[model samples]
Target: MNFSAPSGEVVADRLSDFGIWEAEYRQTLQQFVQEVIQQAETDLEQEPAPSRPTDVDLQALLDDLRAEIAATRFALQQYRQSLSD
Candidate 1:
């Protein structure tokens, strides 16, 4: 009877053939995730801050409200004139 265990070099070569590719794939995936996270963080940092309500905005809203009130009053006057006529 003659039997011998595989040599260390043979086992190492077989492991490298599969293990190297798996390791490369895992490394690539990890790098991709890291890049995506970094990009998201950078985008969040670059985003503009929310604007606070300013005096100009309030003035513009007030002007719009006044215009609407004037228009409504004018329309009511025209409607009343038409009813009288």
Candidate 2:
């Protein structure tokens, strides 16, 4: 007869539904934030990898420096011999 106002049972059911919806919403929001953080970290690591020199590059540089030092030593020896002769 008085259908305008919801019954007590109806109000309680709606409140329960609202609580469940709120909990699900909070969980989903937290999961989304976690995924965003992980993706940002991955991007940052990748950005630096190309800019940082690898072990192979450093080894190559060292080899070139040794070769240059050897060449300089040979040149100095030849110059000393010429001077003495």
Candidate 3:
């Protein structure tokens, strides 16, 4: 019954089942792949372009950063002194 000739259609039935399984598997895989591709494309499109350094004032930015650092250091020193007291 399970011969190569499919004496009682046994082998033939198995072949049919295999075919159906392959079709479903292929379709599901394709759908998953397409969804990932679409989402990646959408993310890329929504993201903004990066800023160029030439477009900004380097000196002004450096000054601002230095001021912020000084302020933070002062705050930290004040807090530590308060804790010691």
Candidate 4:
């Protein structure tokens, strides 16, 4: 027994199924969006403030260069200390 129709009944049923699927799909999308927003907020909460250069601020490209120099100095001092010991 094969039943098929080009009538409004089949169209209505197909549209109802599509409506249900769209609602569920929308809910899933909303959840993912909310999760991303919350994760971003949490990450921002944990992040340190960015050091911006101002008139009073010592922050510069030179600061990073100085840090590297200080690290190398410390390492060299440690090597010299180890050799002396």
Candidate with best TM-score: 3
TM-score of every model versus the real structure = 0.44, 0.52, 0.58, 0.54
Q: After superposing candidate 4, which stretches have Cα over 4 Å from the reference? A: 1-5, 52-85
lDDT of 3 by residue, 1-85 (tens): 5556546688788889999999999999999999999999999999998976677888899999999999999999999999999
Q: Count the backbone clashes (under 3 Å) in each candidate.
A: 0, 0, 0, 0
Top lDDT hit: 1
User: For model 3, what is the alpha-carbon lDDT of residue 42?
Assistant: 98
The candidate with the higher TM-score, 1 or 2, is: 2
Q: How close is candidate 4 to the true structure, as a TM-score?
A: 0.54
Q: Give the TM-score of candidate 3.
A: 0.58
Whole-model alpha-carbon lDDT for candidate 1: 0.95
| lDDT by candidate, in order shown | 0.95, 0.93, 0.93, 0.93
Worst 10 residues of 3 by lDDT: 1-10
Cα lDDT tens digits, model 4, 1-85, are 8987678988999999999999999999999999999999999999999997567544676898899999999999999999999
lDDT tens per residue, model 2, 1-85: 6569888999999999999999999999999999999999999987855555445787788999999999999999999999999
Q: Count clashing residue pairs in model 4.
A: 0
